[model samples]
Target: MLLATINSSIVLISLPAIFRGIHLDPLEPGNVSYLLWMIMGFLVVSAVLVVLLGRLGDIYGRVRMYNLGFLVFALSSVLLSVDPFDQGAGAMWLIVLRVVQGVGGAMIFANSAAILTDAFPAHQRGMALGINNVAAVAGSFLGLVIGGLVAEWDWRAVFWISVPIAIAGTVWGYRSLHELGSRRTSSMDWWGNLTFAVGLTALLVAITYGIQPYGDHATGWTNPWVVAGLVGGIGLLIAFVLVEQRVEDPMFSMHLFAIRPFAAGNLASLLAATSRGGLQFMLIIWLQGIWLPLHGYDYESTPLWAGIYLLPLTVGFLVAGPVAGRLSDRYGARLFATVGLVLVAGTFIGFLLIPVDFDYWVFALLLLVNGLASGLFAAPNATMIMNSVPADQRGAASGMRGTFMNSGSALSIGLFFSLMVAGLASSLPGSLRSGLTAQGVPSDVAGQVADLPPVGSLFASFLGYNPIQTLLEPTGTLDSLSADHATTLTGKTFFPQLISGPFHDGLVVVFLAAAVMSLIAAAASALGGAKYVHQED
Candidate 1:
């Protein structure tokens, strides 16, 4: 579980190196979509399939499915590590392998808790779950550090590093982990699976594409394909619900929502996850794009430093996760879960107060506080949900839980990026035009260039590329500028300096939106009320 979780997170930190290694600019027009999809496709696929795969575990054996997951995951890691293509082909291969890896991830995610539930008694379940959940959450932040380190040496090393660990985990789990849970002897819920998978895949794909510019607009929301995907996906999901209700053995047990604890816990989890999912990416971009660049770090080195700077956040999570879990085991989960979310909301507010170029110590401390709050919320909330289900339903329940969490993550990515892009769109062009014109660029050229979609700036910042160079290249303006002027324009200092104000303005919107969502999540957590520990009927 630790190894799998770590690998899942490590990719985010390595993205810059990976893009460079593949000789692709993540910020290139039309390329941002691919970059976003590559980063997010693993999560989307995992979210969509977890429920279906979890039901499979219920029918088949959880241990067998989990073991298979390890093998598939390991194989995909090998494929990603040894990717032979360069440029677009390489990016495609990575995305494809990542999707395959998500399949493996779904198996592990769906079964891990059910396996633990089968092994641990009810009283000890909270403690065990807390440890597992903490590892999973911590692994994400840990991935940032590991990815930075490995990617510094070689981008492929990020994927390579996972292989041996996965092999060991596969062997260990196969040898030691036994199937102790009840298995249902029922047919697969084929219709439910098909509808749910297709619907979710379409919706997430739409969201992924919607973050990219389309037909001269700042975003793709108005694109016919995106609109169709969103609408069509929702329709299918609605149909899936109807199918599940009619089916004897459903992929996701609709009746599970009847339990107040399960229903409310899942809702709160979705809300919390939605609020939290895109946060790490946003923070990473903020650090790498604006803060690090301003603080004497080269754009190329920003990715690595961003990871290092954020270490305090991980520290907080490591400190708080197990401790909160243990406390929740003794007391009910409500106090911890509710308080944790409130703290998260406070952290968002704290973020809003910090200037874009604030001191490192202040940013680090705030991140640590945020991590602590997240850790406090994660374990207890998860335990509450898991404990509410029947023994035989644990696999499916875990899958449903994962589906909501991962889907929230996907949705959050879309929402955060959309909001940030919108905010940037409003202010960035004017800033760019003014800044470029001040540097003696022709007003007409600058105006045309500024009018380009703000998604470009977001992607440029994310990829550690100099936006000025990208902007000037197509216009033949770079060749026209004097040596000194061109040098100044393309230099590390100019682009970041130019974009800071507009970026901060955009970030305010994103952060405040996150803060609002976090508040709603806190309210949902409060509504979930006390944790209910279940026994066999």
Candidate 2:
């Protein structure tokens, strides 16, 4: 689980290095889709396939499916590290392999919880799942730190690190683990699987492209294809629900949602996951794009430092998660889960209060609090949902839970980026034009640079690239400027200062929305009612 989840995010911090190694410029207007896919393809595939894969696990054996997943993961990691092409083709190779990797990841995600539930008694399941869940969630954050350290040595090393771990896991799981969970004798729901996969894929793909500029607009939301994807995706998903109702052996057990704890816990999980995912991106951009650079870190080094500095957040999770999980076992998950989300909501409001260039201690404190709150919520919520379902449906329930959380992470990239991009678009062009022209750039050159989509600039910053350098170099404007002007334009502080106001505008909306979501999650968590475990006689 750790290896799978770690690989999911290891690529994020190492992307600049990976792109450089592939000789692909991700910020180029024509190549932006490649960049988006690089980040999202694995997530989208995992989100779409987990339920189907989990259902497969139930039909077959979870250990069998899980063992197969580790083998797939091991092979895909090797393929990812050894790309035989460059430029767009190289990017395509990596993206395709990543989707394969997502398949392996989905398998692990779908069965890990059900396997644990089978292995542990009810009294001990909370602590066991809590520890496991922490590793699952914390691995994403740890990937940032690990990716930065490894990428500094070699870009391919990012994928290479996973090989031995996956191979070891495969062997160990095959030898040591056996199927303890209940299995159903049923055929596959081909229609349910097809509709769900296509529908979800279309929706996520549309969301991925929605942040890019389209036909003079700041975003692709109005694009014909994107519109078609949205409409079609939603239509098919509705069909999926209908089909599930009729199918004797449905891929998704819609009836499981009739259980209050399962339904409400999933709702809270989805909202919390979305907010958590958004927070990760926002913090990375905050550090890599603005805070770290303004504080004198170089663009190329921001990814590493950003990861290191966020250790407090990881620590908070490590400390609180198991404790919360253990306590929830004795008491009820309802109180802990609800209180945790309320705290999570408070922390988001705390973030809104901080300045763009915030004091380190203040930022770290808030991050720590946020992490603690998240840890407090995650295990109990997961335990509550998993426990509420019948033993026979545990695999599907785990998959459904995984689907919501994974899908929420996928959706957050689009939702938050769109909100942030919209905020940047409103005033960024004027700021860029004026800032550049004042620094001795020609008016036409400055206008052209400013007129470029704000998404490019945002991505540049997010990827730890010098935004001014990237924008001005293409126009050959920096060569024309005096050394002083060039130096000021490319220096750490200039772009961060220029963009901070607009960035703050976006931050306000993003963080406020996150806080609201957390509150609603808390409400949902409360609605989950008292702790009640389902027992099948």
What TM-score, over all chains together, does every model reach? 0.97, 0.99
Question: What lDDT would each prediction earn against the true structure?
Answer: 0.84, 0.92
Candidate 1 lDDT by residue in tens digits, 1-537: 677667877887788789889998777665676688778978998999888788888889888889989999999999998999999999999999999999999999988888888888766777788888878877877887788788889999999988998899899988998889999888888899899999999999999888878887898999999999999999999999999999988888888888877887788888788878767878877887778877778887777777778788878888888888788778867888888888888888888898878887888888989989988888888888888888889899999998998898889888888988888888889889998888878999999999998877677767666668878888998888888888889887788777788877877888888888777777777777675877887
Pairing residues by index, what is the TM-score of model 1? 0.97
- Report the number of the highest-TM-score candidate: 2
Model 2: worst 10 consecutive residues (lDDT sum)? 1-10
Write out the backbone clash pairs for model 1: none
Residue 463 in model 2: lDDT = 93
Angstrom error of the Cα, residue 298, model 1: value is 0.5
Q: Candidate 1 at 393: error in angstroms?
A: 0.4
Residue 254 lDDT, candidate 1, scale 0-100: 89
CA lDDT for candidate 1: 0.84
Measured by lDDT, the strongest candidate is 2
